[model samples]
Target: MLEEIAIEDLGVIRSARVPLSAGLTVITGETGAGKTMVLTGLGLLMGGKADPGGIRPGAERAVVEGRIDLTRHPEVVGRVDDAGGSVDDDGSVVVVRTVAAGRSRAHLGGRGVPQGVLAEVADELVTVHGQSDQLRLRTPAKQREALDRFAGSEHAEVLSAYRAAWTERAGLRAEIDDLTSRAAERAREAELLRLGLAEVERIDPQPGEDAELTALTSRLGNAEELRQAAQRAHDAVVGLDMETEGSAVHALEQARRSLEAVAEADPALGEQAGRLAEATYLVNDVATELSGYVADLQADPAALETAHQRLAELGTLTRSYGDTVDEVLRWASDAGLRLLDLDDGDDRVTAMRDRVVELDDRLAELATRVTAGRRAASDRLAEAVTAELSGLAMSGARLEVEVRGTEPGPSGADQVAFLLEPHPGAPARPLGKGASGGELSRVMLAVEVALATAGDEPVLPTFVFDEVDAGVGGRAAVEVGRRLAQLARRTQVVVVTHLAQVAAFADAHLVVTKATGGDDVTVTGVQQVAEDDRVRELARMLSGQEDSATARQHALELLESSAVGR
Candidate 1:
């Protein structure tokens, strides 16, 4: 429910902060009072288009803000929590909107939000039924929805089941259509997959094969140079040299004998002679190994040519598939699987068809149950709506819910319409064509009452009625007030009217008044009247002046009667 509304620099409302209660909050004042401005402010806060012309003559901007308590609104609470916004200790949500020259902004829980978000949240919080509510009834879609609402929870359950079934059937039908439409494309894809798999298999590339080939190729290309280098190393380590007196071993042995001759002159020279003898022996063993390596080293041209051919094959695979042997091998593995699937297409399609049939059977069963449930609900709804219409002074009118089968839809397979008869012995027709403006209001009231009592959840938290009492007065106006008050007990309702009887029914009254200063004129102020003041205001509404004795007495009596009922 709305907790408060604050308006500033908006048309005739300069600065006004009006606190609201949870029931039927009424706004009334003189014919030209800024009452309409209050409703406009609400519309703006709900993301309605902002008019730069709505700003006061001397003001640069206009602002409208409202605070709502979500204590009973679990849906809104969950949304706020999901969005990371705060819900106050009392579970109240704050919504604010500001408009300047040509720009506008909205805020929720003090955090900035897009105007669309404000509109979404506002839609969950309120519903206004201004004088134009009668015309809205003329729409066929709305008429259908109203009928559904009156049908209660049974219809909702049926609708839910029907919609689920319809969705599954529709989705499968779409998939089949798509597949049927592209048979040629699928065949082309199958051919491509088969060709790719065969091509890759012909090469049969192995992991790491490319690296092995590269190493072999490098060795073969440098075979002559490698053989020459190996020969030189073998000779340097232990090969006998014809130019020298002897091999390294022989030279070391000659040096050892000389060192032994000098051993007696110094003890350190004796130890060095023994070390040289050991080195000469080790050199002879190494020379034998080097001779073996030199004998084995050779270059084979045929083997080098074979390695070159293998490298070229790998290069082709790299170009078409991957840069490395491992990547090419992986591609081969995946291609094999795709090839198998394409060859077995008929078997795969058969399996999908079997699964689809099973789903279809289950969906059909649910749809049958849904249709039965809707028929039952339609009967109950018609009864409730008819009961409410009697209280709205349409005692002779007949309210009916006409539910019939229709093509599958997101809602259900059932189409519901509301029919009405305005007078006794009159032929019943659709509500849109059978009811007049005043009669539409009465019918709307009946539908609202029936929907509220029948449904498990309320669709809207607030209802706005603009000139609902356009042609009603006396007892009829009082009845309208009574019905509004009853609705207020369940949800907030706001009405804009010039009738004093209607205004007198409000739990809280706000007056809009225009003021002129010097040569400038603007609707810049609003006042909330208290109990005694409200009586005076009502009297003024009744007789156009508070000083009228007859108006004051009647206003006092009205207040008393309203109090007694509460």
Candidate 2:
């Protein structure tokens, strides 16, 4: 429930606070006293579009703030929390909206949020009905929604399941159509994949084979040059003629002999002679290894040709698949998997078609259940709404909910319509054609009250009626007030009305009055009237004369009668 709304610098309401509570609260005022501004403030809090022109002259911004009690609406609290906002320990949240310079901003639970968040939260909190809603009630979609809401939660679950099944069936059918239409295309693609896979299998390239073969080919091509270089090094290390004393080995041996002879005179000389002997051994080992290398070196043209041919085959695989042998191998592995899937296309399509058929049967059963539920709900809804219409002074009017068969859809295979029978023996016609503006208002209210009473849970935490009694008056207006009080008994109701009878029934009555300053600047104020003040306000609303004794008496009588009705 909305605890209170504080509006500032909006239209003629420069600053005003409208207190609200858990029962019917009506705001009454004369024609230009800013009564609509109060609702405008509520609209802004509900995240409606903000009009910059509604801002007061000389004011930079317009602000509308509301304090809502969420103790009974934990779902709304969860929404606020999800938007990074927190509720008070008492289960209350403050929603604030500001409009300035053609832009709007919203804050919930003191946390700044997108305007859409405010809309989402507010949708669950309040349902606003006005003259426009009366016309909306004529729409088939709205009529169906009303019936569904009356159908309660169990029916809602069925509808949900049906919609899910419908979506799945639609997807399956689309896939089946695609597969059937592209049969030739898919066959051609599978053949191409088969050909490519066969080629890759025949070549059978291995990872790193291209690099390994390149190295072998280079070695074979330079075998003769390598052998010549190795021989020259070998001759230099030893000597072409081993008998000559010009080789490194002979020189080192001569040095070792001299150093050893002087070793007894100098111990350091002995260490140097040992190192020279080790160096001579290492040189001889290298000369032996070099001779072996020269003997092994051979230009095998046949092996070289075989290596070149294998490299060419690997290159062919790389050119079509990847930049290297390893990459080609990966492509082959992926293609093999794709080929398996392609091979199973017909089987997969047949399975999907079979599933679609199963889904069709399931959907038909659910749709039948849904249609049966709707028909049953529509009867109850029609009877209940008709009962409410009788209380709204349309005792002769009856509402009929018609369920007709239609193609299966997300909602179901039923097209629901609301028909109105103006009186006995009158043909039932669609609401738009049979009901007057005043009758539509009553019917819309009847539907709301019926919906509220149909379900275990209340329709919403709060309902705001913006002159739902626009064209209603006399005893009918009094009954409208009574019915509103009845609804308020179950949930909070706020009405912006000009009828004294309706305003008199409100547990809380607020009056909007316009005052002009010495400078001739006009402003409006909203004050909750009480006792004699309430009577006088009602009197003023009754005959445009608060001081008239007759109107006052009439207003007093209205209060007495409404009290008895309550």
Candidate 3:
């Protein structure tokens, strides 16, 4: 609910503050007293379009501010926080808007915010109904929402479930399209993988095989030279099968034998003899290993050819998949995993097709239930609103809520609309098309009255009407006032009206009085009036003479009767 609103330097309102209450608050004044400026302030607070012409002459900027109680509206406060703003200490939000000649700015909860942020949050905070809203009532979507709201929780629940199922079905269909659209691409990719795998399998390359084969080929290509070198080294280490050659082992043995003969004469010669014997043993072992190496060396061309052929095969694999045999092996391993994933395409298509079918069935079931609930509620809403129209002095008017089945939407498969027949024997036509301006206004009022029954609905916290009472007077205007008061019981209501009967029903009445200062600047002031002041205001409203005894008495009677009637 809106607690207070302060507007400055906008239109003819140089400065004005309106303190609102729970029930209806009516703003009334003389013709040029700037009564509509209060609603203009509301428009700015709700993030409406700004105009430079609205700036008061010689004023630097025009500003509008509002304090709204969020005790019953935590979600709106949450939105404020989401926009990086904070609420007031009293837990109410402060929304302020300022307009300059060439620019405008908006603030929420004491922090600067984008106008769109205000637009988004204000949608949940207030619903403004005016002459234009009566025109908007003719739209089918609005009609559908109105009927659904009248259907209460049952319709909302069904609609919610239906939307969920519909969304699921849409997602499944998109997935199915994606999978089906890529059939040829998947086939091409799979075939390419198969050919690469076939080439890798034929070669049967191992990790490091390229390096191992290169070493083997190098050794085999020089086998002859390696054998000759091995034979020379063997001959040097041990005595070869040739004359005039003495091996190291033989020399060492002779030295040990000479030292042993001397050891009989000296102990020093005995230690020298032991060292020579150990050297002779080591030399003999080396000679035996060299002899075996020389005999085993073979310069064979066939083995060399096999090694070169294997190296070439590994080269093919390296060029195709990697720079080396080891990297090629890694590529093969990764490709194996990818091949498994690619092979599952057909299976995934089947699964998604099944899911789409399941969602379609569920969507149909939910849509059916939603349509049923909407139809049931449509009857009740039409009956109630039609009765309200009669009470609003459209005695012969009838409201028909038509709920027809259509393709499924987020809400449901039901397309709802309202038609009006102003009297008997007249063909029923859609709301704005059939009704006159006065009838349309009354119809909107009646719909609001009917909607008041939906207290449990999650709707806007406040409703503002800009001259919704236009073209309405007498008993009809009083009925409009009572209905607005009735509507306000569930939420805050502010109406701009010139009807004294409507003003009489307001829990709070504000009068906008404009005066020309010494500088010839027109300044408007808003004052909340009660008791005698309100009566005098009503007297002026009724007969344009506050001091007339007859008007005063009549105004007094209106206040008393309006209070009793409420």
> What is the number of residue pairs that collide in model 1?
11
Q: In model 1, how large is the Cα lDDT of residue 370? A: 63
lDDT of 2 at 118: 84
Off by over 4 Å in 3: 110-114, 132-138, 186-341, 434-438, 455-457
lDDT of each: 0.74, 0.88, 0.83
The sequence of per-residue lDDT tens digits that candidate 3 reaches over residues 428-508 is 888788566556777877887788776384554587877777777888888888898888877788888898988999999
Candidate 1: tens digits of C-alpha lDDT, residues 267-290: 898999999988876776676665
Clashes of each: 11, 0, 0
TM-score of each: 0.75, 0.72, 0.72
lDDT string, candidate 2, 1-566, tens digits: 99999999999988999999889999999999998889889988988888999998888999999999999888888999998898999999999999999698999998999988888887788777765432446578778877988999899899999999999988988888888898899889889888888988999887798999999999898999989999988888888754348788778888999999999999999999999999989988998999999999898999999999999988888898899989988988888898788788889999998998898899999999999999999999999999888877788889999999998888999999999998888999987775665677778778878887777775465888886787778988998999999888888999989999999899999999999855577899999999999999999999999999999999999999999999
- Candidates ranked by TM-score: 1, 3, 2
Error of 1 at 128 (Å): 2.1
Top TM-score prediction, candidate number: 1
User: On a 0 to 100 scale, what is the lDDT of residue 402 in model 3?
Assistant: 92
lDDT of 1: 0.74
Residue pairs of candidate 2 with colliding backbone atoms: none
- Candidate 2 structure lDDT: 0.88
